[model samples]
Target: MSNEQKQYLKKLKNTKIKILFWQILLIIIFIFLWELLVNIGVISSFIFSSPSRIFKTIIELINNNNFFIHIFITLKEVLIAFILGISLGFLIAIILYQFKLFARIIDPYLTMLNSLPKVALGPLIIIVCGANSKSIILMALLINLIVSIITIYNGFLTTPSYQLKLFKSLNASKLQILTHLVIPNSYQTIIASFKLCVAQTLVGVIMGEFLVSKQGIGYLIVYGKQVFNLNYVMTGIILLALISYLLYKLIVILEKKLLKHI
Candidate 1:
């Protein structure tokens, strides 16, 4: 409604456009440089595959009818793990928030488990779940679940003290206070947890795939290594990077939509 506000919005839009332009330009430059260096013999194509070689590898995978299969498998695992992680984490965080004594009792153990290297549990997971997708999903679930709990639980704890006192003074029930005040106040944190969960889920899925999968990008990377085909490895990495970027962008869009009210 005001000229100043309109100009500020225009300026912000231009800044975002400039940022996108630079990001795309940087990727193009990097690819061009990589290809140029490989062509000039500055880097061994066998070890550090060229962008063109990666493209060829992707084409080869497509011709072999494995490209979509691999992508689909990995994406499915990621989606399943992400949803489970967030849901379980949210439930657990709520329980912890409601029970201060229990939260204190388990805090150290949670910290320990979080700090432990998850890959170390791979062999045990395979032993228990068998060498299948179950193991992969479990491995991914184990990795992301703890992180979601911690991030979201901490977010819940950050509810304003004054608000808590006000709710108490109003004789509100605990559930009413939580529903009306605490959870609503942590919407940003919950969305932030979603972003973290997405990335963590991807990492877990890849790790699980590496350990037990016959299909997926992680399997592709391992297979490439065994066959001494660095191009496949590079292509897998590129595909993963693209997947991660797209997933992050989706979360950002979701964040914008969800937090528009805030």
Candidate 2:
């Protein structure tokens, strides 16, 4: 490589480092200020729990052997919802794209469902799917599935017309063209959808938990509110944040690997 290219790369690396440094510094400063405010009686710990108290509550949860159970329940719901959402969405999108008549027919219905607020269906879903974890997964599906189908379907629609004609001229079947061109070309869109699906699934699961779950982080938040335990509420929120970040980071890693080709 040329000296100029090496120097440019080094500069970019240094810039990334500077960004990371500032992010950490800001978090530390914010935590310090928050603790200071709580310690000085500016904010009551009962209503607004400090970072230390949040950490302490987490520790207590660990000691009680309840941390992993709650985390696991939520994670299970999220993973199942994510998998089903993406797979079903992608499959349905392919079918719709191949059959333009079907696509046009259902376009309005899909649009309607996507815009509908999913929470309103919670009770009906629980009534049908039962009050157990299936309802939670279905709740997540209600959110993630529609979003995924719309995103991927639109991405599929963006395939170049010239390329489609070329494939047609060569006597390529719709499935063959889709496998060879449309789907492969839409990797960035699919990967982007993954990030959104994870978050939506999490939201759905938490909402479901709020309504039906006896255990899980969402339940903890509700229970905390009932008992006026800000520590529990704060801890539940912190854990939820951590879970979201970890899921997002995993997608980032996958994006790096897949998007490098882009």
Candidate 3:
């Protein structure tokens, strides 16, 4: 590589490191301020819940042997919903891309479904799926599937028309054209959809848990609210934030690896 290119790459790396450093620093400062305010009389420790209080709550949950169980349940539900949503969405998007008439026909319906508030269906879902993990997974699917289909299908739609015509003139099969040109070019869009689906799936899972779960972080938050123990609520929120951040970082890693292979 040229010296200019090497220097550019080094500068980019340093920028990323600087951004990460600031992010961590901001979180530390926020936590320190929170603890300090709680220790003083500025903020109510009972309502706001200090960083140390949240730490103690974590220890208490660990001692009770319920912490991991809750985390495991929520993670499992999220994983299942996420995988199903993406797989089905990808397949359906391919179908829509191949059949233009079908795509046009369902376009309005998809938009309507996308705009619908999924939480409103919680009662019906609980009634049908019986207040279990099935309901949770189904809720998440409903939330994420339409979005995945729309995002990926739109990406596929952006495939170059000249390339499509060229492939057609050469008697290339639609499958060959899609595999070689469409999907490869849409990797970024698919990855973007993955990120969106991750967030949507989490929201759906939590909403389902709020409605009818016996275990999971959502249930813990609800339980804490019922008993007026805001620390547990705060702890659940913090855990969720951490989980979301980790999941997003994992997706970023996946994107890098996939792009490298491409």
Best by lDDT: 3
Question: Residue by residue across 1-262, what tens digits does model 1's lDDT show?
Answer: 7999999999999999999999999999999999999999999999999999998888989999999999999999999999999999999999999998999999999999999989999999999999999999999999999999999999999999999999999999999998999899998999999998999899999999999989999999999999999988999999999999999999999989988989
Model 3 clash pairs are none
Overall lDDT per candidate, in order of appearance: 0.95, 0.93, 0.95
Compose the digit string of candidate 3's lDDT tens values, residues 121-218: 98999899997999999999999999999999999988889988988999999899999989998999999999999999999999999998999999
lDDT of 2 by residue, 119-162 (tens): 99999999999999999999999999999998998899999999
Error of 3 at 223 (Å): 0.7
Predicted structure 1, TM vs. truth: 0.95
Taking all chains together, the TM-score of candidate 2 against the true structure is 0.96
Candidates arranged by TM-score, highest first: 2, 1, 3
Q: Report the Cα lDDT for candidate 2.
A: 0.93
User: RMSD, each candidate, Å?
Assistant: 1.7, 1.4, 2.1
Error of 1 at 61 (Å): 1.1
Model 3 weakest 10-residue run by lDDT: 253-262
